[model samples]
Target: MREPVDARRTRILAVVHARGAVKVSALASELEVSMVTLRRDVEELARTGMLRRGHGVVRPMGDTGPTTVPAARGDEPVGEGAAVGLVVPERHSYLYETLHGARTALEEAGARITLHIAPQMAGAERPQVERALAAGVHGLLIAPRWRSAAGEEADYGWLAEVGVPTVMMERRPRPGSVLHAMDTVCSDHWYGIHLAVDHLISLGHRRLVLAARNDSPTARSIRAAFAEIAAARPEVEEWSVVLSSPNAGPGEPGTLEEAPDLTAHLRERGVTGAVLHGDEDALMLVQRLTENGIGVPRDCSVVAYDDVVAALASTSLTAVAPPRAEIGRAAAELLLYRLGRPTGTTGPVRRTELLPRLEVRGSTRALLRPAD
Candidate 1:
């Protein structure tokens, strides 16, 4: 006969509490059992509201007392008496600006911010959230590192159950899920892409191409938006979208240098204009096109996202300018609202979506010739 489920659950909870956290497989091995048996035990304990399991490990039972989430940031150092935890995913300047804006806003409002960065999972956010809760932080402003909204609620719900208010920055809804409740701030990607497409179409670009990364939610949105816009333009008949690996190094089999294939694809489809997802890649794409004796804006027009340091660094790039400082300030303010320092009201559940402006530069010109 199988061991009683209640006894197994109690043993699992006890082990999780005593060990701080335990993997399901570890529990199985330690108890001289199979993985399936341990999983059933963990599931029963979870249903009873004893411990929380995510990814692979089981987190401790919730503290019934009121909880505070400390702001943790990777850009700043950890200190004693820091009541808020700010979790910055990685140390990029753009990300830093967002966090800095949040920090400045919070400080002006007399809130303490402890910034923590996790290079990967183990190095930062997971441990920081745990410690902040243990140290008495009542709320958390987590700039989640998820690429998509799917499966995010399970990770974040744990924070809510423990009585911590969380604000996700730069994230939008997944296909069948809604992660937006407290507040979410993201670039107006669909509208931005609309501007890009319209600019190309107006410039006589009947054959257009989009070069974008296929993995990110932002990239996926851009593609979907592109398709929506294209379907409306019957005059624009021949267009092709070439997906490229965003981080593939130069000269690799799948690298952006595959621009030759991209250009070939464009030529075959009679493409005369291109929309780039990132400015860095946009500049490179233009340079490659020019090297192939193609005159940008003269023979082909282009537009890209983010006219920041990358766009400015390029000699010429017609790009979308995300309101960087404003986005930073808005994220900070929303977080403060969650922290109870209401700046402006979008009612109780604060939500704001910011639009991006198109910056027309030297890269795009009116298309004079028809696709041949």
Candidate 2:
């Protein structure tokens, strides 16, 4: 028997209320009705302010938008007109790439974004975030500069008070922390470090030194992952971590006008293979190693992290590449999904991690002989 028009409309309302949003075609298919009939029903419901219409979709009244919605049915621009804020550290090229990726996706979705760069200082993120909030953004995408554990903890109070949907980009709060329940997009740095270590071990490298910065969360995570991976490997005879650059951070090993004597340090311990963090430090260290009579991959094999400029180095460094732009894309996509729900909607939070890949190049090679 044909469902009555009033009955069909009521059912549609129930589905929309439950799902938050529904595509027009999906609603029609579920009701076993034609597009023409569904349109008439939707129009009536919208006229009564019981339903909201979007590009080929329908939502319960008071909904902001749809979450991770598909391209869906008809000829209409798909966008929510939401205003969002983005925060990232200044003078960071890697994160700049992430920012660009997010900007494109949000623009396509018809959302306007306000960008703020937090200078490289402790507690720099909060004030910029306040500005964004004052601007009345509906949501936020932030990559906070958690230079220290205390700095990260300090932001928790204000972040909790933001009172808007937020997504973190490339920053993972420690488990059991207040921000742990927040949404995040991060690179699987542990896996990236494993790839570097595994590659070195496979090439008969027994001794390794990780020259990395203690500056950012990514650098710290890589350092910790390297330590863990290096210790567990039976083939790895010795491993130690050192500062990648002068004035890097955390003030271990102190700064020197002349770069640390990495060549002497490696030779003193009979260490062979080295994994360097970031492009600039790796390039500089590689040059210094050359000047000190250590040929890359010939005297001491090296693997650099952060492929941003690794391949462009003089020796073309073998490096690990975290998915930078993808982190931004996914972060933005998740934030959009968060914005779709009605105000005060509470849902399960997600932590997304994208894996990084190793780019093999001339800087790393098979062991030709024992270290001289």
Candidate 3:
């Protein structure tokens, strides 16, 4: 049963006047009202000049007392009580850091976060998003598991009309598509791949091989970027792409299994340099190479794609480290700006990209010259 509007506002104003200031979450809980209902009441009261709504806190107009709430993140205030939904694929350590970054930023800005992890399967994100929407989230941050263009397009129509501020993390929509107009923040993977390939070429490596997964959007992008980079470079003598794992088929990304060891193949093909996607695959392949009497940086140079565990490898694998956390922070900040927009004004869509860096380690070295 809905409480009478006058009664609710009377109680709300009483609490604010008594406490001098209160967080939106605490106020809503005290009033035993839904956030949606509380937001409507607050908006109404603010319009009638009864209260002030800013910095995600409600306070009486003349009240200047200190708030019990902790200091917020940035100097600027995001609207109080804003809750956002975070959806990511399961078991993605790379994205887990992204989630943490977003959580920190939102919590610092005085916003609430509702997290939902999509299971590793096709069409898992929609239901989770529906749940968030039903619960009245003000915004969303999603890293959809897109294995192919078709897979991504299937979600575009519905996602574009989610009716709230949304920022995609580490995912890019197709050019001119409906989602292309949506806000997004992703690391420049092409630039990351280029950094790895260029690093290898500068070390006098001509023959290169890339063993990478073909399961997710990042994996597909890395594969294509490697092919384009290797083909475009006249310095590259031979390059090839092989499955890093045979577990996930090209069409489905549920099972990520390791591919057969390629130690003998690398020897037969005279490949002196290799780039491996993901930290685990690189570590495992390097172990296999060592078992076959091939020493890293001596017989074969390796560059791992993800840096999550690359630094922990026995050889301390050199890696292209994407700005995983920044992607989330940027996305969250953008969404907050959208949420706090002055009424009757909508902002332009934004697509932001952060650069990745090369972490040089013991895994790569300059090739031995004949003179030496």
- lDDT by candidate, in order shown: 0.64, 0.84, 0.85
Q: Count the backbone clashes (under 3 Å) in each candidate.
A: 22, 0, 1
Candidate 2, residue 246: lDDT:
74
Q: Highest lDDT, which number?
A: 3
How well is each residue in 202-290 modelled by candidate 2, as lDDT tens digits?
98889999998877789889989999999999999999988888766643234232336798988998877999988888999999989
TM-score of each: 0.66, 0.77, 0.79
Model 2 is weakest, by summed lDDT over 10 consecutive residues, at 71-80
Name the lDDT value of residue 150 in candidate 2.
62
Best by TM-score: 3
Worst 10 residues of 3 by lDDT: 70-79
The regions of model 3 sitting more than 4 angstroms off are 1-55, 58-78, 248-261
TM-score of candidate 1 against the unseen true structure: 0.66
- Model 1 stretches astray by more than 4 angstroms: 1-82, 91-93, 120-125, 148-162, 175-178, 246-260, 341-347, 370-372
Error of 3 at 229 (Å): 1.1
Clashing pairs in 2: none
